[model samples]
Target chain A: MRPTVHDIAAAAGVSLATVDRVLNRRPGVRHVTREKVENAIREIGYVRDVAAANLAKGRTYPLVFILPASDNSFMHGLNDEVRAAIARSSVERTAIRTLEVPAFDPAALVKVLNELGEERPAGIALVATDAPEVRDVVDRLVKDGIPVVTLVSDLTGSQRHHYAGVDNIAAGRTAARLLGRFLGGAKGEIAVLAGSMLVRDHRERLEGFAAVIAAEFPSLSILPVIEGRDDPEMAHMLVADALSKKGDIIGVYSLGAGNRGLIRALKEKAVDRSLTVVAHELTTHTRAALLDGTIDAILNQDAGHEVRSAIRVLKAKADGLAVIEAQERIRLDIFLKDNLP
Target chain B: MRPTVHDIAAAAGVSLATVDRVLNRRPGVRHVTREKVENAIREIGYVRDVAAANLAKGRTYPLVFILPASDNSFMHGLNDEVRAAIARSSVERTAIRTLEVPAFDPAALVKVLNELGEERPAGIALVATDAPEVRDVVDRLVKDGIPVVTLVSDLTGSQRHHYAGVDNIAAGRTAARLLGRFLGGAKGEIAVLAGSMLVRDHRERLEGFAAVIAAEFPSLSILPVIEGRDDPEMAHMLVADALSKKGDIIGVYSLGAGNRGLIRALKEKAVDRSLTVVAHELTTHTRAALLDGTIDAILNQDAGHEVRSAIRVLKAKADGLAVIEAQERIRLDIFLKDNLP
Candidate 1:
């Protein structure tokens, strides 16, 4: 027979009630007593059967997801996936709640983090605003014995346990390489469209794109990025204006969301011109654009995978269990018109 | 206030013991009695918590993996992933066994399937041979109440519950587009390499590749396929001879294994040739070749993902539960030098 709570209690020289409290993580157990019980359980090689334990104790993992209040297809898709997870809350024993804050506002994110410290949830997952203040709060939360994971946009130089997103730099580098190679010795300028450089993912993408373009494709020159703030109207206007002004531009790389406007601009301004385009995200607009020859390639991160990975990592951390690292890796999905899924 | 087995028993007008037999799948209950209990479960919307039930009964799902005895990097990687799953058998509550048979031998596969009827494993996952005999055996297993999943390669016109692999046709179509566009307006013949035309995946890839190239890329023409038998010596010899003879061949597509041999052939014969190559699978040899410009792009299926997905689907089927459809999709990973991982 497997080792039981009774065995743990015996080994720890503690009462069954104390063992029960420690096992269920209930209050009123002294710190020394808890450690003693934990040590005994470890020494006895007791495998805590989570499914049975959850049923017996009604153990629930209270997980919080902090997202940006950005109106984009990607963000909407992410919210949908979180809602789906919420629907499975009963079966999975997870109580998930979402909090949205102003995009790129470090102070707002920090305020939410501070509030979460008081709530003491089992785990917290967030799209971090890459700022020192946000990092400080995240580090503080880790120090306070909370499991923290960064979602789509990661927090740099922080004590976060895991990042449930792709390598933004590699995504950017891939975009640059695809665009550069597709152009194939064509001497021309390239236009870059981005939501904003303030966010770490966007910045990292730009950095990688620029680095690869400079080192490998010296014939193709990169023009200044058109920051449309990920708004369709703003992106359309800026892209159309840029395309009209830059007649020598042969390629376009949309490194961030809001591709609806970019597609509209490409069709209107670059229809007669022989221009190659690469983009991010696989929204309906981008998918159609790719099929119609407006975009050559798309580099995407699956929002569903990110959300699921975040929840899995958070749950594993909560349970003090190691996750399958390879399984949790959010692979960058590169889609061409032929391989769109 | 969730519905319990006792509630089900009361609703079904059966004894608690009868309800327990139906729930645990014990062989004592009559067919009509089982149906009544099942109908009661459905009517009351009683959710079966697998974790709790597994703990109560120590239920172990007996899953068998059938693989081809091919000595290649991809097959080796897949075997490693299966071994990894076997290592986690205790935590996952799985009793996994693997059977290897000759590659592309449908008769051998059918023999194994016929023998498995007596053993009656909870689930079976197999790399299908795509023969009528294999399909018939798979259908028989499904009819016999065994949950069946096709891994890596799928069996067509069969009753397999799921296919834990990529869409090979899409992969081939994407490869053709990538190769076609990368070559620009250059008029040349393309060399097609394959392990054999017997497997469904290889045949589908060629079909998609041919259709796309014929429909879109008018300037490029395909040469006769060189069967390498997934052997390094055979692939190297055939590829080297083809490159030597077909000076007009500007691009190459390796739709199957033996990429190591292809890489060696490229280095030995086409060292200075500006040949555009697209290949399947991303092993160490292929990754290095991609970085060195020997292979321009790599199309891959995550073996780990497929293995885990098969296990999850099997477990869910055994427990009469539903799987998250989107979560179980095995995506095709497209790797360029810039985004190797």
Candidate 2:
């Protein structure tokens, strides 16, 4: 049987109140009496239950999630996950609130960060833009003893305590391999689609994808990149324009959202020939495209998993507890039509 | 501020002790006074803080995990995850004990189920063998008011409260798609390696793989399945023999945890040619093989996630609380060399 405070009290020949004082590290216990209680506690193997103790002390964590207000399915899904977290906040003993700023606006993000720094929340999680001002603000938060976690698009050079997202570079390289293997020695040009070069995730993915394609599939040439800004209409226009110009394009690799536009363009232009397509983010549109073979495969980072992981990390950081890294590591999920869920 | 027990006592015109008695459902409180206190509680919207109450009551759930005693890497990883859970039991307010029965022995599994049912632990999580007797035992446990969760392998036609694993059929279909796409229009024989047909997961995966191959890739033919029983030596021998017999084998799909043997066999025989290999479970061996270009892709259901999900589901079931189905759903993860965690 595990030893309790009462057991320590009995072993030390002291009162239960004195033992409680010693256990809680409260004042009003003499050195000799404290030493006796400590010795008794040491004699018996007793591990204090941290969760129970926190509950008994009525502890609650106040956390903030800063997200980019983007009109993309993936960002909407991420926001939905955060709202789900809020719904579960009472049970988890956390007061979670979300702050949304304009997407891709580093100055707006920095301004919000400065405002949050004044209040000093227990922790902050944000989808960061890799700008000097944003990095400075993140470092300031860490310096002020507020744990910051970069969610989704990470600001790697910043002092963010953790990143709750997949490695974009690896995801891109995987996409390249899948596209290359699926095409199988077919000599044709491959077109690349991305949200913007400003976001670190997009740029990193492009770098990885280009490197793999150049190293492994030298037969297949890559066309110039099209920056879609993750806007469906803009992506569709850009892709349609590319397809109209390049008659020999046989493959398309989309390393961002705006798959709706990509799908529309494929439906319109690639009707003559079946093109091998690999896309990122499994939204309703992407799922349907995958089902109908318009898109061959999808590389996904689950927004729900990312939000939940961020919350867990923030809670652990607040308590100075070690997280189970294996459990917390976000996997880059590759999806085909067969394994949709 | 939220209404506290003090406010309930004041509103109900009862002493603090009487309120405590009513709240705790202790004896000696009159029916009229109990109704009054309950009415006061309802009037003030005073939802009981369950975590604090559990702390005061010193409640700890004793959970039992029944696993297969197999030397396979997946089983070892599962056991290690359970041990990690046990290490974290105190903080999570759970006492986790593991019971190992010999692999593929339904009688031994049934015996352990009977013993666990007799003691009636708060919850039971098991990698179930889909036999009538095992299903009956699981139903009996549920009828006896015990929560039962089927882990890695599920017993479908049973009253298990939850299944904390991926859909095996989907996983198999995924493998078929990957192999079919990677081997792109190549007319050659594809070999299948399974643990056993008696296990429902293997059977389901075989069914899915066959269905997809028959419908989509009629060019590629599937050979008779070789049951390796998830033993490394047996798998290696079977695979080597198959490779020796079939001169035009271009692909291999392993839907079980015998990749070590399969890898050895492939290295010994098929060293000159690159075969499209799709395997299940990502252990250290599989990860290394993937990085070194031995294994092309892996379909993995994370053991750590499964163990943690089972515990969460069990605790929720024990408390008769609703679970967030989306949060609890285990994902089927697809990993290539580049996207490996």
Candidate 3:
């Protein structure tokens, strides 16, 4: 039989009610008493019956998901996954709410995080901008006992408990290797389109891409990156302008969303199929373009997995439980038209 | 405020003890009395506080996962996901036990399913084979009040509560479109490598691939399918023999596992890198092959997502709850070396 609260109480030589309060992290328990109860729990190898314990406590994980308000397919997919999670909340017994701040607005996001601290939700999951204010907010949330998880874009050197997204550096290096080898030793200029340099994911991707290209394919040159802000019109204008200005451009890497604009630019120019086009995220637009030879390959991070991972981390934090790191590690998905899922 | 058991008992005009028995699904309450209590619960929209209720009852979900013993990367990935779930069992209040039977052995799989029924776990998740005996065994488990979910390959017309896999037909059609278009109106023979027609996923893939190739790329001829039983040596031998005999083969579609063999055959034969190759699953071998220009595109299903979906569905069904259909729907992932994750 599994060890129970009674065993913990006996081992700690504490009252049953006191043991319960300490186990639940409830108020009124002395620090020393709580430490004793925790030590007893560890000594006895007690695995709390989470379902039953939550039933007794009527616990509901109050989780907040912060995402960008960009209207690109990637953002849309992320929002849809979050909404799907919300729809399942009634059954999962979670109270999940999403907060959308403007894309690239670190100040607004920091403000929202500061406000959320007062509400004291069990956990917070956000796509962080690499800013001191955002990091400070995350640190405060952690200090206040709220677990913070970074989604999509990570905030390095913060108090965030976990990150639930793909490795951007690896993704970028993979993209560079693909482009270099696929062109069969051809020397040409490669153009890059990014959402913004401010976002860590985009910056990391560029850094990795450039490093690989410079190390492996010295013959190829990457032009200055065009910041599309992950907007279709901006991407389209920038790509078209680059193609016209640089007639020798032999490759294009759109490491951000707004692939709709990239596709439009490629189509308008009737870019040769041999140009080695690579983009991020597989949506209806990108999928069609891939089949039609407008795009050669796509790198994607499953939004659903990220959202689900965030919830699991949040719930575990809310319940004072440990999370399995291996399970929570999100993989970057690479897609070719032949292998589009 | 959430409704409590006391509210339910008072509303149902029953004693608290009677309400307790009904809420726990324990025996002793009359059929009519149970109906009254259930009706009260429904009218009040009272979702049992899962955490609190589980605490009071000391209930934990004992789940059994039945997977095929295949050494392919796909199966390995699926097993890894199950291991990840098992690692999470302590905190989630779930006891996960995995039972592996020989791959494609219907009798052995059926026997395991029957044995699982005897154990009477709260939930069972299995990759179903297309056999009536297997379906019958699953039906019996369902009848015994165990929530059963079909993982990866599903059993059609079975009493299983959920299927956590991609639509194989759509995956096949997409694969065909990619292959046909990538060939770019070139007239050539396409070789298809399959595991076996006995499996539903392989058969559906062939059907979808054939349908699209026939409709859109009539110029391309599909050669006879070579069944390698998803074994590397067999696939390698068959593919090498076919390449020797059919020198004009311009494309290859591998609709199942054993890609290691396919890669070996391609490399030994020194097949032209320009030949459009599409295969399923992005394993280490496929990823390397794609980067080296031996393979063009890969269609994939994330085994991790499928396994996680199976667990979520089983847990929800065991709780007598409905799942979010969109969230549970598995996606088809496409990968090219350029976009490899």
Candidate 4:
């Protein structure tokens, strides 16, 4: 039989109240008595049921998820996943609330971070707008004993407890490799579309893509990056303009979330020639594009996985517990039409 | 503050013992008293702390993981994942044990299943050896009210409660797509290697691969399958023989384990010409091979994810609770050298 609080009390020859005091780290217990209880706990091998203990003590984690107010399928999916967590908040003894900041607005994000630090939620998980001020505020929050985790877009130099996302650089390299190999020695230019250069994920992805193409596929040339701001119409316009200018463009790599625009442009230029395309995220648009043979492949990070991973990391951090690193590492998922789930 | 057992006791005007009896579903509780206690529980909106409640009731799920005693990287990895679960068993309120049966021995597997059914574990998760007798045993166990989940390789047409693995048919189709795209109009024979035709996963994968190749890439002729029985040495011999006989083999799709043998044969060939190879699972050998350009792509279902998902499903089934279907859907992961992790 497993040991319990009563077992520890009996083993230490102390009153149940004194045992509870020591277990809960309550004040006013004598040092020797506390040590006795601790030793008894060790001897009896009492693995505390943390959830039950928290319930008995009437403790609930107040967590805040800060997401970007971006009208994209991926962002919408992330929000839905967060809401799913909220549905289970009562059972988990957590009070989770979401705060949306304007997309790509670093100053507004910094201001929000400062406010949250003052409010002092038990934990905070944010899709960060990477900036020095934002990093400073994150550091300050950590210094004040609140656990902070970066969501999809990570803050590289910040003192964040964990990152609940994929390795963007590797994702970019994978994209390049896919596009390069899919082209199969065809000599033509490749067009690149991204959300923004300001975001670390996009920048890192571009870096990786450029590095791999330079090292491996010297035959293919990458055109100037078109920033879509994750807006589909903007992406559509940029892609259409580029495609029209460079009629010999053999491939397209979209390392951002404005796939609707990219898809529209591709459909408009629906010629008999095969154009290799790779994009990020699996949304309704991307899925259809893949099915119709427009997009060759998609590199996705599951929004649900990211959101769930964030909650688990934040909870573990709040409780000073070690997380399963392998379980928490959000995979860079590559999808073909055949493997779409 | 949230309601506790004490709140329920007071609200129902009953003793703590009465409340405990009702909550734990213990015997000797009067119907009217039970109703009053349940009413109090509903009125207060008390979310039962299942972990704590189980602790109080001394409930621990005894689960068995039946794996194949195959000396292959994937099987070893699966066993390691099950061991990882066992490491957390104490804290998770589970008693997990593993039983290994000889690889590909359906009769032995059926015998083991019959014995386990008699032993009457709370739950069972097995890498099923597909056979009618095995299916019968699974049905018998389920009839005896024990929850069973098929892990890794599923037992189709069985009474297994859940399958914690990827869709192998889709995996196969994805492999064909990758190989077809990578080969890009090259007119040469493609080699197919599998673990065994007896297993459902292997059969399904072959079916999918064949269907996709026939429908899409008619230029590439498929050579007859070579069954390695997931043995590396056997796979090496068969691949070497096939390579010698078919010098014009342009691409190879290995839909099962024993990649070590396949890698050895490829290394021995040392051809200047490129052989576009696709395989299943990501092991050290496969990772190194991918980096060195021996393998083009890898289709994997995370063994860790499968084991964990199976445990969650088994536990939920045992408790007659609903599972989050989306969360439990194991993704068919595609890996390139750039995205090895």
Candidate 5:
């Protein structure tokens, strides 16, 4: 039998109402009393019966998902997946609202997080910008007893309860191995195009890629990173500029969202499609490029899976239960044109 | 705003006790009374409040998962995921039991299904074999009011409520496009290795692969299909034989499991890793092969996701509620060594 609220209350030598206030983070509980209740909960390992408790309390978790206001195919696909989740919210007894923030703007993200903290939804799921101010806001939300989960891009060293995305380091290492091997151990230059160095995902990917290339494929030399900001025009210009500057490029790794610019650059440069090209995410643009031989492989993290995972984690945290870790851990997906799903 | 059992009973002109018996399938209600109550339920669209109803009745859904007894890494990973779910059963208020049947044996699968029918678990999840006998057994279970869901390999024309697996047709098409483009559009013969044509997944993959090859890359010729039955030794022997006989084979697509054999054959033949080879599932063998250059791309369906999805669908069905289709749809994960999670 699992311990319940009554057990925690009894163990803490407190009333059931007091325990409820502390557990739900309702007002009117003293700091000492709240600490006692939390201690008792930890000691007893009292996992709240989410489904049953929510039924008795009539609590529907109100969750907000914040994403970038980008019009790229990947962003549109992500928005679609979130909308699909919203449509199913009624059945799951959840109230989900989506908020859009400007891409790569720390001030905007921090403001949104602060506003969300004031509203105090049961939980917040956001694609975070890697900035100290944004991290502070996320910490404030957690301190205020709201569960925060990072989706896609994560903010490190925050009080966020979970990250519902892939391991970017592993994804990058995998890409380097593929590119190095596909190039047949040839000595050549590899070009990397990324959204931005400020984003944690991109940095981690570059780190992993560089680590693998240095350790395993000493023959290939990687050029300085190109910042595309995940904009097609920027990516095209940067890639084209790099190709013109260094004509010996044998491989390209786009560890960012937008691939349209990269595809356009490759086509315009008339770079042989046989040159190993690996990019991140599978959208309409990437899919078409992959099929047409412009893009070789794609590293993807399923948006639908990530959205669903966020909801599950938020609901679990709101109900004061531990999530199944293995089930919640999102995987890095690799796609070739042969294996596109 | 949802209708309750009382509304159903009132609309059916039946007593609450009779309605309960009919709703729970307790075997006491007369046929005419059951029909009337069911009709009323259909008219009212009275979706049972699963959480509240379970709490009131103190009912825990007992779900049985039937898996293959193969001792491969993929199967082990699937089993591990299922076990993780089972460990959370107490907290989730579910009773999950796992039953393993001999791999590729329809007789054993049918026998197990019959036994599950006799045991009458609240729900059953099976990795189906494409056999009529197994389908009949599944139909019998569904007829007896037990919800059955197919995992991984689906049983066509059966009364399975859902398929918690990737679309194999799409997977095949994706593989063909990848292989064709990866080979640089060179007109050469491609060999397809499968577990067995008797399995619906393999057949669907072959169909899709053929469709794409015929429609898009008419220059690439497909060699006769080789059935390895998902065994390492058979795959090794068959692939080696095929390679020896067909000297001009430019690409190979292994749509089934047992990639260990495929890797062995490639290594034995001293075939250059540059030859386009696409296989399914990212086990240790396939991952290492991919990294070392023996395997070009992996078309994977995350075994963990499949197991978890099966459990969710089963629980939802047992509760007499609709599942979120998009949330439950398993993705075909494309993996390269560079993008492996």
Candidate 6:
């Protein structure tokens, strides 16, 4: 049988109330008494039944999800996942509400975050805009004893508790290697596409992609990156122009969400050209593109996984508990047509 | 507040005892009463607090994991993951024990299954041998109300509830495509490596790989399969002999284990030959090979995820609950050197 509060009390030579206070991390117990109770808990191998404890206490986590109001498939999917989580709030003992700030607007993100300090939720998760002011506000919230985690895109130089996303740099490097090996020893220009240069994820991806290409595949030179702002029409126009102007472009690495645009450009213009392509995000469009041979592979981060991880992390932090890091890791899924989930 | 058993009883116009009997699937409840309780549960959204309910009953799940006693890295890793799960049995309220039968011995596997009927575990997860005797025993267990799931290698035409592994056919097809694309129209023979033809996964992988090669890459031809028994020494000897005898072989697909020996063979005898290689399972040796350019790509099914998913499915089955199919899907992870976890 598992040890209980009585066992800890007896071991620590303390009263049951003192043991309960120590177990709950309540501030009333003196340091020496708390340490004694803690040591007793360790010695007796006592484990708290957290679910039962929370049920008795009628505890509910009020969580706020701050999302970028972006007109992109990925962001929309992220929002949908959050909504799904919200639907489970009653059973999960969570009260989740999502706040949408203007995309890439650091000032607006900071404003929302500062307002959260007044009506502080148990935790906050956001797609960070990678600005100094935003980082400062997040750190302040964390300092105020609120759990904060970055979703999808992470803040730079921040003390956020966790990141619920894939390693963007590694993703970019993987893309480069896939493109390089798929193209063989063909010496040609490779076009790079991005959502924006302002986001840290995009910049990191570009950096890793360029580093790998420069070091390993010297035969292939990367053309200037085209910022599409995750807009399909803009991406299509930009990619089409790049393809038309550069007949030597033999490959493409799209490291962002406007894959519908990228796939359209490839199908319309590059159908006659034997250009190998690798793109990001596994949406309906990207999956079809991969299946039809328009795109070679897709590097994907499961939105469900990211959202779930964020929620799990937030709950754990609120409970003063640690999560198994391996279980919490958001793996980078490399999807080929054969292994599409 | 979430609805409770009291609420379910009031809504269903039943006694607390009737609600309890229906909720726990006790044999005493009438069909009409059980249906009323179930309908009330749905209407009032009375989700069971499974953990708390189990805690109240002091319930513990007795689970059995049957694995093949194969001398290979992948099986060893699988064993490790099972042991890890066993270590967490106390907190998870599970009593998990592992049984290792001789590899590829259907009779031995059947004998173990027959013995488990006497023990009567809540759930059974086994790496099936794909023989009729094994299938029959598994069917009998299911008939007796045991929840059985196939792990890693699946049983063919069995009454198993779920297969907690990747689609071996898809894995094989993917390997074929990767090798075919990497070869780039080179008219050469491809060396096929296997653990054994006795296993379903190996045979299915070979089948899918061959079909894709025949349909897509006509220039590439597959050589005879060399069954390694997943033994490094046997794999090394056979792979070395194959390479020495066939100078036309420009590609290798190591669909099963013993990749350690395959890497050694490639390094020793095929160093001068530029053979595009694809292998299964992510081990230290295979990962190093991929990083060092000895292996082109590694197609891996995370053993940890499989084990965890099996446990989860088993628990859900024991509880007569459903799992999120997407969350439990064992994805085939395509690990390039750049995206190595």
Which candidate's DockQ is highest?
6
Candidate 5 per-residue C-alpha lDDT over A146-168 given as tens digits, one digit per residue, 9 for 90 to 100? 99999988898988999999988
Q: Which candidate achieves the best lDDT against the true structure?
A: 1
Clash list (residue pairs), candidate 6: none
**Tens-digit per-residue lDDT, B1-341, candidate 6:** 78999999999999999998888778988788889989999999888888678879889999999988888899999999999888777778889999989988999999999999988999999999999999999999999999999998898899999999999999999999889888877899999999888889999999999999999999999999999888888899999999999899999999888888889999999999998999999999999999999999999998999998999999999888878787888988888888888
Cα-based RMSD of candidate 1: 3.0
- Error of model 1, residue B115, in angstroms: 1.1
- Model 6 per-residue lDDT tens digits across residues A168-189: 9999999998888888889999
Instruction: Give candidate 4's TM-score.
Output: 0.93
Off by over 4 Å in 2: A1-48, B1-48
DockQ of prediction 6 = 0.71
Residue-by-residue lDDT tens digits, candidate 4, B73-154: 9989999999999989877888999999997788998888889978888899999888888888899899899999999888
- Between candidates 2 and 5, which one is better according to DockQ? 2
* Model 1: per-residue Cα lDDT at residue B32: 90
Q: Each prediction's DockQ?
A: 0.69, 0.63, 0.27, 0.67, 0.39, 0.71
lDDT score for residue B62 of model 3: 94
**TM-score-based ranking:** 6, 1, 4, 2, 3, 5
Number of backbone collisions per candidate: 0, 0, 23, 0, 8, 0
Question: Could you give candidate 3's per-residue lDDT for residues A20-125 as a string of tens digits?
Answer: 8986668999889999999999999998876666655667788899988888888888999999888878767788999999877889999999999999988899
**Which of the two candidates, 1 or 3, achieves a greater DockQ against the reference?**
1
Q: Candidate 5 has which clashing residue pairs, if any?
A: A174-B337, A174-B338, A175-B338, A334-B334, A334-B335, A338-B174, A338-B175, A338-B178
Angstrom error of the Cα, residue A87, model 1: value is 0.5
Model 1, B14-84: lDDT tens per residue?
A: 99999988877799888999999999999998897778788877789999999999999999999999999
Report the lDDT tens digits of candidate 2 across residue range A102-180.
9889999999999999998889999998888999999989998898999998986888889999999999899999999
Model 4 deviation from native, Cα RMSD in Å:
3.1
